[model samples]
Target: MTATARLALTATLCAFAAPALAQEITINSFGGAYEEAHRKCVIDPFTAETGAKVNIVTAYSADAFAQLRAQKDAPQYDVIHFSGGQEIVGASEGLLLPVTEEMVPSLADLYDFAKAGVANGEGPAYQIAAVGLVVAADKVPSEPTKWADLMKPEYAEHLVLTNITNGYGMIGLLMLNQIAGGSGDDIQPGLDAVSQLLDAGAVVVSTSPEIQAEFAQNDAWIAPYASDYAFTLKKAGLDVKFIQGEEGTPASFITANLVAGRDNVELASKFIDKSLSPDAQACFSEALRYTPTNSKTVLTDEVAADVVYGADAAKGLMRFDPRVIEANRSAWTEAFAKTIAR
Candidate 1:
């Protein structure tokens, strides 16, 4: 071969080998179906495409955050999937990287709310999580149409309350507070509302899956749960439904964030982009029933109701401002802890 041809062939060979030389990325994610979904839709595809290994670490966000915090000076994972509020907290505390659009092209696939609100700011990088209330449709009389109705007499004993320490639990209480004629400014009444429910014999559940299983077995009826768990029960043929509660239940969101300090930033960006693509969005909605931020994704008619940010419910959805929650977290947790003491 001529010198020029030999040089061109060598360049192509190096280009092909570059991705394999890219660094591997480790991600700590919440376990259960989310982990499985990530495996099927993200990690596998990414590794297959680039020949780079992706290790997913499964654990609770709280535990993962604590671990990550401990390793702040020398971070272990190259990407972290955490709650949007937690992401904000980490970013504020200097535990996370401020992701840029250059790292995650998927930012363009996200919806306006997902992009601008809590997750991806304007340009790109992290993604906002989607969350909502999960309830069984048959147990209650009025369908539990709105966030306010959960406080009614019919739902009094039938409802299951999540452990108060969880952020989403506080969101549920905040919704109740708003329904009970209080604003975020005054959440005491919301606490009072939950107090009345507890007094009325509502069950308190510690995990989302447990709450879901109880609902499926008819041991419990309603639950304020994440959208993903809601879909899990529904798939098992339970008579459950997820309503975008009136006044809207707080959407506990997380930004799909990548650790910028990694050597695999390019590959990490590719994985992020593919996961947020329309095809992946549809897969996520159909499999987990979690709403996808990609506007182009479609869902089955049955599932369409449960997807929080689907075409029908996107316009009226309400989400708790994470900043607000973080600001008042201490006071809120203290009040909730007081309720637990009672």
Candidate 2:
């Protein structure tokens, strides 16, 4: 072979070589169907592409974060997934590693909401789920196309609502306030609406069981909740269907973060990049009903119709700043509790 040809062949061979030296990483993230979807869509594909293994250890963001803090000196998991702004708190407190464009080159392509500072400068949002109205298809007296339609007397007292303790719950309240001419720091209109709703017989449910029970046993006909959760109900054999109201949807995300002291940083970053890729992002939207952060991901009409998708779709959704939600979560929780007590 000629010397130039030999050099070209060698370069091509080096380019095909593996990027991640480590073969495994421990990950803490969402479980059950969420995990199943992630495995099929992101994890399995990543393993196939990089010959790396992902060990999913189930835990909520709070639990995983506590564990991360407890084991910061010697990290237990290479990566952790957090929802809402919980991961942002961890990032701000220096519990999670600061993710850079260099580590996960895919970061540059993300939606503004999924960028580093969104997670307090520590992580990137790979998946997002929208908040919408979940209706018992067989029920809901009308077509249920608009957000304001929730106040129709037909739904009064029969609707199952969540408390602000749930992220979407706060979104719902803020939505109501906006509908009633209230905005930021002024949920009094929403509070008044809820008061009227409860007086009219609406039910306030906090936990998941309570939500399912209200639907499964109590003949509850309507609810405002996250798309993933509402889809879970649909899968469980309820006549549940998620709908995007005329006002549009509100969404939050699951942030993938690297642990500060993880040993397999390269592998973790590769895994994160895979999760944010078009193929994996599409999988997330298709399988688990989560929205994709990658702009390149395309979804079928059937799939896109259900979850939040597209630039115009995202821009149209009723999203507030994450910092706003993070700043007032506690106070809003207390206010919601007080309002419910009344």
Candidate 3:
């Protein structure tokens, strides 16, 4: 065809492509600084790379699950991000799609355990948040040296806890319970331990900002929380200390789940792939202080030294089986709510 004919054909194709290109994929992400890091490190670059518009919707993991169940027949979100093992329950109920090496080739690039979503058979593990205890140096008379330190006479009523409905809250329960000689099947010991604190007036906080606020006012002395949040609290100028827990910390990973029936599978898959990519992983680790699951994303010595990094470091952390946690989470939450009701 002549040059003018070729130009006319290209223009027609471009006109037809406009609508599809204009299509947007919605993602439910964690709000606050985590969301900001995701927007900067993952969403922004993905948009710049593919010209795809991504809309970010924020919800806590449990709330996101509830929303998914309510919108089951007519789903609203394209990709759902979850911490802890909510993905397992979502996957079993067919609310989420499977994420395997095929969906994200970078699956091979992540740690072996990270390849599976908390062993829950859900989507890919994009990032990991190490759950542990954070102590307020100024409030506590002495440094908290172990997980059992919260139950000590000096720290009663000063403990800040995340509630059961939240992911960190669940992890805190499991960690303390395990330290008190309980397993995933029994969170009673954990509850009993924290119940003492609650009885003495320990504060229960559901969000990172809430934890920080409670600490800033010297109302809370210590909290069982993620390592990232400890750094976040410190950076915000709280005189705090992050304890690695004499009994190690639990790993509550953030996973990327595809909505069971979404129109933008290709786009969504691309976004997930990019989220686990080296660049995005590094950005999240450095900026948000999350533990990177992508093995290929090497961190500088300085950054790695401060946070959980590498296969050895990650393995050193504690992990609850997602299936076990899934089975007992509902019951545990009810018991925990009652324990802290005082």
Candidate 4:
């Protein structure tokens, strides 16, 4: 073909592609400085690649879901990123789409435990991530080898907790119970341990950064730090360390579910796959300090030590089963509220 013929054909293709690229998808995610890191590393790069604009609106999952429910007739977003617990509850209420490995090819990179177990079963549990104890080298005694150490009287007045009401905190409770003879399938022993911690006088903070800052400011010496928080502290030159704990560590999965009233199921699936890719997982793991669910991707020595998903570290982590939690959340929360009020 002539050069002019080639130019005309290319021009025609570009004109046809412009409309699809013009459509921007909005993603609603949980708020925190960590969300900023995700936006920088994940959302923005995705936008730059596909010419699909990504608007990252940060809101707590519970509040966002309430808003979504109210706006059911006119849904505002295409994708929602939230806690594994919330995703399970949302799936039960008929609010989410079941994800398959076919949809997210990156699923193959995850560990067997991360993929096939109770956490990421045939359809329910979507993604896996961790939350563990953050201790200052100067303050905590020997990196608190186990969850039971948090309740030790020596650290009583110095501990900063990040929301016992949250799922991560609940997992911490479960880990304590595991140390005290409780299993994930049976969180009662864990709940009992939480009650004990409260009685021992643990200070509950509003956010993960607050927990990190309190420790860094020397206002408090130790806390149940989010994995992200601990990484940030270490980067800032703080004498900080994360302990996966001998009894076990606590972790929660982040899930992406198909929203109702959307026609882009295939696109959503593609997006999920991209997010779980080794490259993307590496980006999140290194940049955001999250342990990637993709088991094939290796971390740096320091990060591997920090990741609860690593083989050795995995042994120390209490399994997260969202389906079980979904079945009994209300009852557990009610019981927890009652205990807290006392």
**For residues 1-342, what per-residue lDDT tens digits would candidate 3 score against the true structure?**
999999999999999986686468988887887788989999999999998899877897878889999999988888888885778788889888766667778877888777655334477777888877787877777888778887887677787889977877887888888888997667778888887777777778778788888888757888888878887787888877666777776888788888877778777878889998988999998896788888888888756754788877777676788778777777887887788776
lDDT of 4 at 193: 62
- lDDT against the true structure, per candidate, is 0.68, 0.80, 0.80, 0.66
Off by over 4 Å in 1: 1-19, 93-103, 117-133, 213-219, 327-330, 340-342
**Shift in Å, residue 317, candidate 4:** 3.8
- Could you list the CA RMSD of all candidates, in the order they appear? 4.7, 6.5, 4.6, 5.8
Number of the top TM-score candidate:
2
Model 3: clashing residue pairs?
A: none
Writing each residue's lDDT as its tens digit, candidate 1 over 66-97 gives: 87788887777777776645666666666655
User: How does candidate 2 fare on TM-score?
Assistant: 0.82
Q: Which residue pairs show backbone clashes in model 4?
A: none
Off by over 4 Å in 4: 1-23, 72-74, 113-129, 151-153, 182-206, 213-221, 235-237, 309-312, 319-342
- As for lDDT, the candidate ahead, 1 or 4, is 1
- Compose the digit string of candidate 4's lDDT tens values, residues 1-342: 999999999999999986685456667877676576667666777777776667677877777777667777777766777765565565566566666767767666666655552232222223345666788888765567666787788777777765556666666655666677766566677667666767787666656566666877745666765676677788887877776666556677665666666656666666666676667766677776777766666677766666565556565544657666666677776776766665
